[model samples]
Target chain A: DAGVTQSPTHLIKTRGQQVTLRCSPKSGHDTVSWYQQALGQGPQFIFQYYEEEERQRGNFPDRFSGHQFPNYSSELNVNALLLGDSALYLCASSKLGLAGTSEQYFGPGTRLTVT
Target chain B: DQQVKQNSPSLSVQEGRISILNCDYTNSMFDYFLWYKKYPAEGPTFLISISSIKDKNEDGRFTVFLNKSAKHLSLHIVPSQPGDSAVYFCAALAPTLYNFNKFYFGSGTKLNVKP
Candidate 1:
């Protein structure tokens, strides 16, 4: 079975530009979540998508948004990118009902570099 | 504010020894905790987890301990091997009314098991 997969292993962008990263959840998974990991730091939650709607979001600004397709794939879009936005964007997938034991499997994050 | 904190940034231990990584959280509502291992250029992989109802959970050589009162959790790896050397992250899940189980992670701790 295929695990969670992410597109564009690495990206380079300039200030005030926009970038889109894609994610394919693990087989049999439905929920998709996005996270940002800076160098030498753990990931911080960006938001989560379930049933094609954004269910929850973190402290990030409005410049960050995402969408989930019917097939459980997801896309994270960041507009007006800043140097601080340069980090590893990670995608994680899990089932919905298993609330108590919600085990999330992650993908090989997309590294975004804003110059 | 960083809800989850891993004070130790790095640790080195001899092979075959017990490696203990600690994590503390400020949110009392966090009930489910997880530990993940990550290598360079790869997303974190789930290692083990423990819920608030259980103080300890074990799987093979990996174990996780949760202290609800103190809002602290820990991951223990027994007989640490060279292959076990990687960055370890601690995550806490908080349930909200929206039914979105969001995860907050700590500043990872890098472990080096010396042979």
Candidate 2:
């Protein structure tokens, strides 16, 4: 089953511009999460969405926002992009379960380049 | 402040040799740990995981050892091959009242398996 799919594999935007990245969760999965991975660094959690609502968020500022549709698709929007925003935006999908047993499957990710 | 830290920036090993990647965390509240592998221009792929209650977990050629007291963990790959070359990231599951899937990640370590 198509693990996870993201759109606009590569995007370029200038400072102060906004961009929206999309993700389609794996088939049969319900939860979606977004992460930002800068060069030479591991991904940092941005937020998580379940049941069309944001369940948790990381230390990111208000500039970053996300939405999860009823069909389990997700969108990550970054407003006023900065040079540091140039990174790989990853999307992960998982089923809602107890705690942490079910592993999260990731997508190929969207590469955002801010000029 | 990075809650999880992979002290080693990079490691190189010959094929058929054992490769060890280490990670440490400053937060005691983290009860679960995971290892993810990533290649250039790709999102991280789940590799292995270990809970705080378990000291060691093994699967195939991969073995993850955890020392809760020291807040240290390591991933060992035996008979490493060229395909094993990638960036390895250590992630911690931070308990949250709302979202249990929240994860904190390290800077990651680059592993090079030379054939």
Candidate 3:
């Protein structure tokens, strides 16, 4: 069984440009969530996708968006990237069953560098 | 304000000894909590978790203790090894009206197991 997988292990984007990071959830998982981990800090919630729609979002701005495909894969798109956008973008997958006790498995993460 | 806080930024423990990492949260609504270990340039790996209904949960070498009154939780690792030297993050499951599986993470505590 494969764990969560993410594409573009590393990315470099200039200011005002947009970038899309891909993530394939773990086998038998259906929900996908994205997080941003800045240097010396823990991962912050970005948003979550379920049933091909964004179900939950954090304090992030509107520039950050995501989509969940039918196959349970996900894409995180950040538009008009700023220098502060440089961070490790993490993808986590979980099976949404009970109300509040689902464990999430994470991917290797994509390191995004906004130049 | 940061909801979840890991007061200790770093800790060093001798190999074969017990390592304890602490975390505190301000939100009483957090029903589930988790611990994750992360190395540089990698996403977090789920360690162990505890529910609000339970005071303690143990898995293999890891044990998590939750104190709801104090709003504190801890991860205890017995026989710490050099491979355990990494950043450890404490995360809480904050299920809101819109999202049932939202997570809030602390800034993390770096654990260094010295041989």
Candidate 4:
């Protein structure tokens, strides 16, 4: 079965510019979450989408937003990006009530380079 | 503030030796702890995890230990190999009313297994 997949392996944007990254959930998964991993740091939660609605969000600013389609794919949009926004954007997928509740499979992150 | 912390930025060990990676969390409400292995240009791969109710979980040569009272967790790899060298991340799941899988991650610890 296919695992989680993300698009735009790499990207470059300037300050105040916007960028969009896409993610496809793993087969048989219905939940999608996004994370940001800065250099030398671990992944920080951005938000989570379930049933086409945002269910949870992290401490990130309003500039970061996301959506989940009916097919369980997701899109992370960062508006007015800053240099600090440069990081590896990670997408994870899991299903509710799965045998392992905390089992989240991740995709190869999209590296965002903001200049 | 970062709720999860892996104070050791790097670790090195000889092959066939025990490797212990530690993590501490400030949040007492964290219900689950997980360890992930990551390589350059890739997202984190789930390694092992332990729930708040459990003290330990083991799979083959990998084992995870949780100390709820101390708000700490640890990952142990036996007979480390060169291929095991990678950035290891610790993530904590703190679910809220709206989200069940939001995870907070640490800064990560880089493990280098020398052959």
TM-scores of all models?
A: 0.97, 0.96, 0.95, 0.95
Single out the weakest 10-residue window by summed lDDT for candidate 4 chain B. B93-102
Worst 10 residues of 2 chain A by lDDT: A94-103
Give the residue spans of candidate 3 off by over 4 A. A98-102, B96-99
User: Which digits, one per residue and each the tens of the lDDT, describe model 2 over residues B33-115?
Assistant: 99999988777898999989999999999999999989999999998999999999999996667444888899999999999
Which residue pairs in candidate 2 collide? none
Residue B3 in model 1: lDDT = 95
Give the poorly placed runs of model 4, Cα more than 4 Å off: A99-102
Q: How many pairs collide in each candidate, listed in order?
A: 0, 0, 0, 0
Error of 1 at A69 (Å): 1.2
Q: What is the docking quality class of candidate 3?
A: medium
Clashing residue pairs in candidate 4 are none
Ranking by lDDT: 1, 2, 3, 4
**Tens-digit per-residue lDDT, A1-115, candidate 3:** 7899999999999999999999999888888989999988889999988889888889999999888889999999999999999999999998876424545888999999999
Error of 3 at A48 (Å): 0.5
Q: What TM-score does chain B of candidate 1 reach?
A: 0.96
Every candidate's DockQ is 0.68, 0.64, 0.61, 0.61
Writing each residue's lDDT as its tens digit, candidate 4 over B6-95 gives 999999999999999999999998887889999987878988888899999999999999989898899999989999999999988775
